[model samples]
Target: MKPQERSELIDALLDGAISEADFLRLEAELHVDEKARRDYYERLELTTLLEIQAEAEAADLEERIVPMPATGRRTAWFATAGIAAVILGAIALLSVVWAPDPAGGPLAAKIDSRLEPSATGFAVLTNQADAVWDSGGALTEGDLMPQGDLHLTSGVIQVEFFSGVTVILEGEADFTIHSPMEMSVRRGKLRARVPAPAKGFRIRTAEGELVDLGTEFGLDVTEQHSEVHVLDGEVEWSPKSEAMRRLAKGKAIRSGNGGGTVELSAQPGAFIDATGLEEKRAAVRASRRSAWLTHSRELRRDSRLLAYYPFDQPAHWNRTLTDESGSRLDGAIVAAQRSTDRFGFPAGALDFSPTGSRVRVNVPGEHRSLTFLCWVRIDSLDRWYNSLFLTDGHELGEPHWQIMDDGRLFFSVKKRDATKKQKDKQVFYSPAFWTPALSGRWLQIATTLDLDARKVTHYLNGKILSEEAIEDEYLVEIVRIGPASIGNWSDPSRDDPHFAVRNFNGSMDEFAIFGTALSATEIAELYENGKP
Candidate 1:
């Protein structure tokens, strides 16, 4: 191969975008041509220097300059033979993938010309709203990363580095791409998954560096310090001004200008993965643009709306669910598993097992007209009554929604039937059609009680599934809405009284309560908007 052609192929290979035929040709040339091998080694050394420079700059350290060889050839500053051996042994890592930049521009233009071939980053797994690129240009998936700061004012992103490290970065965060194997988080929370070949991958923070000792970990950085949590394997935490510490699996450590501290428990769940990336993003967009937040003046507004729970919390063991209405009735989660819902993003929903896990919310006071809506995935029908929503009591006037043993949608409003001969209290039952094998998948449901009309209605996916008329004396006795619970009945008399009975065994997301029945049009819009 000619020198220019060989150089182009080498560049493409380093950048991870060379064609199969070109790669084969380059391999053959390197085996037969001594000069080609030398050129490749020189380029490798040059790439290393550029990587070190990028790392230094990203860490805000004083820049160190290395003079180029007089013959225009680059030699390794450390030992080249060892790097070459490792590179050859890990030849499979050379494969590259590239796609057109989303911003419709050349990805390499912003990179340094001399080290353009080894530009950092592999792909933009995610690019959420309002993320700003400070020095590196706006990036899309598959675009080569130019080493610089990525300042996200709002939104989250997942970036995959060429070294097989994946990082999910949260918004209000700032990050810098130092090299394929190194990065710096100035301010943000990031979850990183590093495979074996990328064992030495390092993340630098304001006060320390986390060297991946073959582990999946998370790093949160602030103006004063950095925190590290190892989810799996082990990691070496080296604080710039303190003694280095080794964090084993399930361990966490924090370092700042003050000193370094080791945490016994992964209490904050720093290493938890993002459960639902897409659903969480949708929830964010909806919350930001929903009529409740963005268009309060419009007629689409419903004043009776009490609470809206999107379940879009960060990736953590415990989260407080915020009520997005004028009422700031926050809910607390207890031992619930967070994961992707139908929407495919992290924190879209919480998973509850037969275990006592459930969410506790302060219920609003009872209203004449009430509506309850949520997205749920049932795991089974083992229990007689699988509760979905329930207030604290089973007394007259309190309302609850559940699924019957035969898979029927059940909703009840407390009332008395005076016609009973013995003066015995009478309770009514209204059940909707049973969806065959309706477990393990997501479904949208709404149950509404319109007191003035004396009617009870249930909706599946926005359309009415069943409706029933109320008795003449039927009255909703719910004086207080809460201390309400979700995913299980409020009955504290079961064998495992602590967890309640008939616990939901699947996921629930985007639950809401309103003081008025939602119009069919409004329900339809909600269903459409909430679709995954």
Candidate 2:
């Protein structure tokens, strides 16, 4: 086909005006010709750019047409430019309004498939109050909910589905999320608010299914029976053995495992709503915050603390991170921005996303045993090694701590007399504990090096993750922390200008170093007091 003819065919395709035969021809051409694929993308880009330019022009009408003195050549140029702009504007308008039906033809289907967004999750756990899971796993606010079962043994949680359905679940409850608009209650109580967009949201029980019709409703499920209460709209209840029945506002029904249904009165007050849940969460957070502050004050007075950065300095002290342990080991903040901490305190954390972002400190002593703990929110593990802390350079007794690309916690101290043959000379690693699902969630990570016991222990959220024996060859009697950096590695010993890119892509709210190795109970207390 000629260039003009092919362009016309693409235009027709984009406008949804291509006939079946023409679409087939275009599909074959796109499959065989690389130029055709490039042309398609180029056209799409051009249309998008034109649309953006049009919107910009509309926003500033005075700047849309600029006056210029006209020469004969300028006049001709302006005429050509005006014609081109008009054509581009028409194309943009057509592209915006005339989308092809995805089911119309093979080409349309292929294009639509490419344009679809990738599905990450069915819903999000938007809010929670004093939640305690049956599995003893931590589920925080703003966690993405995948298609799986949730067993909440205590407290309340609010989940907002992608399809605009909100559900407040009260424990002890067993719930399963099948999709954005579908869920199941094995045994529990829940209140749901379905917007117009999620009108067909359905909840299944052993006895029946309750489908929402743009309404607020509550449900209770047990071993013997299931109850549905329509609070403000309508629902279609389908019993396993009976025909479907529509229930209006202020109506309720009960379906039993024995195959019978009974009418009941809707009690809106029996289930907690979103507003009530939020109020409860606020009270809980305030109480937790107060308890944490009191514990923090006690921690600062502890003699074992070598250095502690609460990251709660006022705006005027942005450049210097205060050392609460009173060791005078202040840190110099370099190129890091302040951010909100996990507990919702403003400027209570330091974000280290930019290159060369770090907190430089000088501890000025060697230790026989050490404990390091911090609260961090990792955004990504993009680098081969995401630095947590590292001494100036790799010398004997110098410690290096970091997260490996595969999500394992890594710590090592250089040994003075290590042979090349020893494979495990100085390195220790915890099991891989981080995944994409954990991105942006605050985590309490702690590592202790107990030289006397010859053991290295790693903890996550106060729970032991791994404990490895410090081999005889790998044991360093004294660990040095004269000059080091948090969230990045900096080597002042090197003459060369080039440096390794090991900066952490995350935020840190609290970091501390103890001269003595803390026991498991101490670590647990720290997590419990500071948890958000």
Best by TM-score: 2
lDDT of each: 0.69, 0.86
TM-score of 1: 0.42
lDDT by residue for model 1 over 1-532, one digit each (tens)?
7899899899899888999999999987886578999999999889877875454344344565444344422345223444666677577455532344556553353322323353434444443433455544555434455556767775667777878888887777887788778888889888888999999998888788889987788787877767787778889988887778888887877777677565654433553255644455667656644533233233224567787777767567557876766588888877678866664556668887737677788875767888889988777655667778877655556677777655677777645433445321223344534433344556788888887777778888788777778766555544246677887766565223323466777788878888887877777777766654
> What's the residue-level lDDT of 212 in candidate 2?
92
lDDT of 2 by residue, 207-281 (tens): 999899999999999899999999989999999989999999999999999999999999999999999998888
Instruction: Point out the worst 10-residue segment of candidate 1 by lDDT.
Output: 291-300
Using lDDT as the measure, the top candidate is: 2
TM-score of each: 0.42, 0.66
